[model samples]
Target: MSTDEDLDRLIEILPKSIQHIIETHQYKQSLVEIVMDLGRRPEARFLTHPEYLSAKLISWQDLDYSTKRLSKFTDDNRAGIERTLHRISCIRNRQGLVIGLTCRVGRAMYGTINGIRDLLESGKSFLILGCPGVGKTTMVREIARVLANEMEKRVVIIDTSNEIAGDSDVPHFGIGRARRMQVSRTDLQHKVMIEAVENHMPEVIIIDEIGTELESSAAKTIAERGVQLIGTAHGNSLGSLVKNPVLSDLVGGVQHVIISDEEARRRGTQKSILERKGPPVFYSALELNDRFCWIVHEHVDRSVDMLLQGLEPRFQIRRFDPESRLSISLQKVDSSSTSSKGKAMKSNKNWRKNSRTPF
Candidate 1:
């Protein structure tokens, strides 16, 4: 999916001087994005390097040169090249004039779910969580493909921001035979999520970035209605997610219940305890610790219950073998206050940090 051809599509829209420097540079292979600000020299972001793409600062003419070639920016300040996975986002001034542009490189990367395909075959809903650039979008695209092409299931992708599919009227080939229902705007993503199920009659609904409480509740409804769901969200761990009031319901949520004095004494715990209010909306959750390693919770209900009880939950650590085979090891997660496992359980980072995302 990281093709020179697709990269060229985005490169074509850039000002000629900046584009020439990008194509001639050695960092072209590792390029992640191109930054063009009104008064700053154009910069190129790579996997391990951020360097200037051009010596001259970007001018109003250069900005207009790129903007005219791209599709009109939406309310979210996002525009994309037609039929390409690349994205162009604008930064506007106080008066609504474009001041900067973030040209993000989007690729239809495959093999993002090499270890999780079997879980998808189980027909249970799954929740994916990770920080930005953890390949969540890439994995969901591959999931839609596997469910549609190999298993022959009816799959619908509620593509908000056109992340899962390409930014075109038709979807990308990476989705295989799955149908895509594009949302008109980011705020209407939940409505499109519900609409895809009711109108299309899909066996599996593939969505990306379930951020808002309405979207989380909508996911619950879809799961309750017997549709297999696969999507990504913002939270890092089960404990952290259950603690977030906005996202807690995605994993059954939690509540403080005061137990009787006798029960508290018998249980050897405080009278006030946190307990799950209902069954988890999704039965399984996959947490990305980088791209190759994943921490998988097979049963969300059992795992959440264990976390609530100040106990460790069991998870399968799936890593790409050095010999190119699947290397799986069982790991237990201790959710008692201080925690450590991987990216999903990082104590230093804000695990419950919420971002306003549609996909």
Candidate 2:
């Protein structure tokens, strides 16, 4: 059976909340226990659902982080406090269903592995931009392994910090047959990319922390050569993502954008209390700027859009309009292109022509 199948079988034996934690996190039991204790909060049905359990863990971490920063906690208490907070964050990530535990950079997530597969099949590439600790290296390594071993695709991994391959010289990680090119601290990524393409002839190239102007340009150039590029960046969300000059250009050309649910939850908390309680809702594809990022499945797109739109303030229902919320039926969009802006109004017109958006 597949690794996913094995994970699913294990999930079947776990409690619903734990299953959610495990699936979101893909962790073993020992790790799950650490997360549960560090991040537990009281709510009647909160832990009943796995997704909510993960969210609760996130919320608790956020609360702890805020409290520690705002209050007069001692310098002596600082290390312990940070350790506690980090522990929670780590668990939250370990339990993350789509992306695994790591640091937060940009809006990137340890996306559902299947999502990466879809992007690869579409004749497009992916860049998983995030900060140092966001698990981009780990996630990308796993992705490379999955593509190479399972999907039978040739992959090259550019290990800048030795994080993806690890310190032992041999890849201590699970990524399969990934051609490793270690970038010395003084080396340039542009030069590394050139060498990988010229020598390895890989179907896809994976890199960690594409931070320079030259690295960004190289990624685009590699893509132009029909070599799929999957890498990471550091940012919080789609909005913050575009502001990053290096990542912005690479992401703009993406056909699909998969960010961590953790980032989504962070954005959700700002909206309303309800948003913080469940699965993260992706924004309308139209509002997104990435040209290659396509919502290929119309039904999934409609579902995500309807859910996200409801969570926004504009669609919120006040007491006066108990009936004010209109029910939105699922409708399919043929494209995920921003150039289709004029078509957006027309498409919405067609949507309204058929049904209303559910609030």
Candidate 3:
């Protein structure tokens, strides 16, 4: 089904007044989410800006009407429509009464992973880093479908919030044939991750929102067992992950080491320096700058080592043109350059131009 049809299902759950405005609004296609508060007028957030949906103040009656129609919110104050990706998060007052709702629209986008199709085929565990709402979940959903359906690999998803598949016993078709394991509580997600590998015997494991330290350690355990991992974490770049004490294990934990004076002088560096503790949980890492642009670090160990030394590392930038063609260019950051921007040095040796759209 098209995204428009999926959005229509989400629209049906809203109050009649807001639903009418959303159905007739000019920017309905680009709608990102709808916000409703107990005392304020309802607002519709779009890709560019937010607009008021109604003039009348929202009442408790309006909140009850929507809550009665949707599934029950979990311990995390989140709920979703069964068989659809749309997510509804609620805010409670001091008395534990629901006072607000944020209805976020979720669309199943195809052809978003064409730029990294080769990486999926390499069978190497990789981690994806990006800020919130940069389409990290959507990207991983498409990857699960492609790896399960096209590559014929056994893929299992560790769906913590039911965002990847949907809020239901049966998962949404966006995940293709990949099996999903739902976690009952947010704190128990790490245990479920380990359970999936111990019983399922899958070739690849897909995880979303890898935040806790226990989860990071579980990821390393899975990698050590020879299972290909496709996971996403919240960070702007590889440098940020290296500095994060909790998530640093995903790229290989960093530690301080002391070297002899003669060795430090030979390398022309300080006697004390930071170095990676051991092999990284993931072999490669990709930064999702946006939906269309991505920065790829083919080697996590090398990139972390370079960053620890205060030197710029080499990476690749992949982009999709308006025609849906994938183009890749290699860039190297010069450590000696005084300017803040890295010097651009393009490489055409491994450039790929695919004419066919995988979707």
> lDDT per residue, candidate 3, 18-106, as tens digits?
88899989999999999999999999999889989989999999999998888989999999998899899999999999999999999
Clashing residue pairs in candidate 1 (N, C-alpha, C atoms within 3 angstroms): none
Model 3 pairs whose backbones collide: none
Tens digit per residue, CA lDDT, model 1, 1-359 = 44678888999999998878877888787788899999999999898879887679999999999999998888788999887878799999999999999998877766667688888889999999888766788788888988999899999999888767888997878789999998888999999999988899999999899899999889998999999999788766665677677988999987767889998888666677667899898989998856668889999999887766656788899988676478899987544433323223222134334442111
lDDT agreement with native, every candidate:
0.82, 0.44, 0.87
TM-score per candidate: 0.90, 0.43, 0.91
RMSD of 1: 4.5
Q: Rank the candidates by TM-score, best first.
A: 3, 1, 2
Whose lDDT is higher: candidate 2's or candidate 3's? 3
Indicate which candidate wins on TM-score: 3
**Each prediction's number of clashing residue pairs:** 0, 33, 0
Please list the Cα RMSD from the true structure of every candidate, rounded to 1 decimal place. Answer: 4.5, 16.9, 7.9
